[model samples]
Target: MEQKVFAFLMFSGQADEAMKLYVSAFEDAGIVSAKYYPQSEPGAKPKVLHAIFSIKGQQVMCIDNQLSDSHPHAFTPALSLFVNCDSEAEINEVFAKLAEDGKVLMPLSPSPVSTLFGWLEDKYGVSWQLNLPAR
Candidate 1:
């Protein structure tokens, strides 16, 4: 089946940093495309305007808040990105990288429903769930 929906992430001004961290944490991830604001642009910070990144081939869209943006909305733990890891080593590696300067809601350890599971909110305020499916 073809993918029709994609996860979209919004950051106040950390879109680029978050994208970099995510891409670096996952082995099969990379920034597909990114548009950034020029310093000359009025009232616009020199930051990511829009970006499309892929994690394990799943396309995710993200953007930094615009100049006219007024909402004080910030990323909440209510929503999180769930990653299914291929192995124990993969989960540990990915989790360790993501956990840097981040909050760990759930320690990486054996869980009731999975062999290994962890939940965290990254330094940029994005939440993520890393899991190794039961074998």
Candidate 2:
């Protein structure tokens, strides 16, 4: 059996906003399911304890503000999302849109392996590695 990749994100009380933004950005994005604390469970806070959303046909799970300020940071460069793109136009559109108000760690240009490639951190603080795979 082959192992699958699923992204689990922890936000500082912005999971709902992030999900809304990402869902609007991706064509087929949708919530598979979600549960709100306290409203659906007893004695819980009103934070997003667990939720799943699909992006571009891929599923990504997330949580929000579940930990205190003492919680250790878990995000890293090694865990960035890898977007497999099919065309330069599509890549440019996504890369540009995501780079708005965000830092572009790597500029979009031709590489030895890709004609369109770049690394960017979106305004929401999520990192994305965009690339147009060889046709």
Candidate 3:
């Protein structure tokens, strides 16, 4: 059976911001659905409990983990979102938007396998690899 696999991003109270940034940065992207946590206490800030968003037709699930600080849920570069960009300009644009306020592991450069490739960790700690595939 063919299965639809979705990348799930677990954020430490940055799910909403990340979702907004992703939806705005990528073409043909938008939030599919989201559920928020109600303000349980006085002056408590509301947060995204769960959400689903698509970036360039790829569906991603995410949530804000309240117990993230104590849990070993830090995002690592081992499992990054590998983006196969359609063009050099597209890869550059996407990299620029996602790399803002983030750390660049590998700057955009041509490789033997790709004309342009780069890896970065976004502000919310999610890792991404942008690549321009051969036509």
Candidate 4:
């Protein structure tokens, strides 16, 4: 079986805001193809139900809190996006931008596999791991 990796982000009732922030981040980073959820039906709760955005050439799936059954822990840092970058410069740029107004779990620096690496939770509280492969 050929499996693919998709990052499904969970937000605490801020999916739309997070999606907007992410789209801005990716666009500022020069990435393309950012999309968001459709408008809800009448009396329906609006949500970022599904989206496909690229981050440094990687496809990522994003969504808002629409389902009632999603557990709180299911949206924790353990399930953050792992961004693989091409250069330290790119890594630093992306990480610093995403870290604004958010918490930094690990500062950008050399890791065993990447020249620059960091872990950050975006302003929306969705965690992400930015890494630049050593070249």
**Full candidate order by lDDT, most accurate first:** 1, 3, 2, 4
Clashing pairs in 3: none
Q: Write the per-residue lDDT of candidate 1 for residues 73-132, one digit (tens) a residue.
A: 688999999999998999999999998998999999997789999999999889999999
Cα RMSD for candidates in order: 2.5, 3.8, 2.0, 4.4
Error of 1 at 46 (Å): 4.0
TM-score of each: 0.90, 0.79, 0.90, 0.69
- Tens digits of per-residue lDDT for model 3, 33-52: 99999878887655789999
Model 1 TM-score, 2 decimals: 0.90
User: For candidate 4, lDDT tens digit of each residue in 24-122?
Assistant: 665443323334456557755456656566655566666665554555534578778887876666677778888999999999888788777899988
Q: What would the per-residue lDDT of candidate 2 be over residues 49-103, giving only the tens digit for each residue? A: 7898887678888888656477845455666788877778778887888788878
lDDT at 34, model 1: 95
> Model 2, residue 14: displacement in angstroms?
1.0
Worst 10 residues of 3 by lDDT: 1-10
Worst 10 residues of 4 by lDDT: 27-36
Q: Model 2 Cα displacement at 104 (Å)?
A: 0.6
State which candidate has the highest lDDT.
Answer: 1
At residue 31, give the lDDT of candidate 4: 26
What overall lDDT goes with each candidate model? 0.89, 0.77, 0.88, 0.68
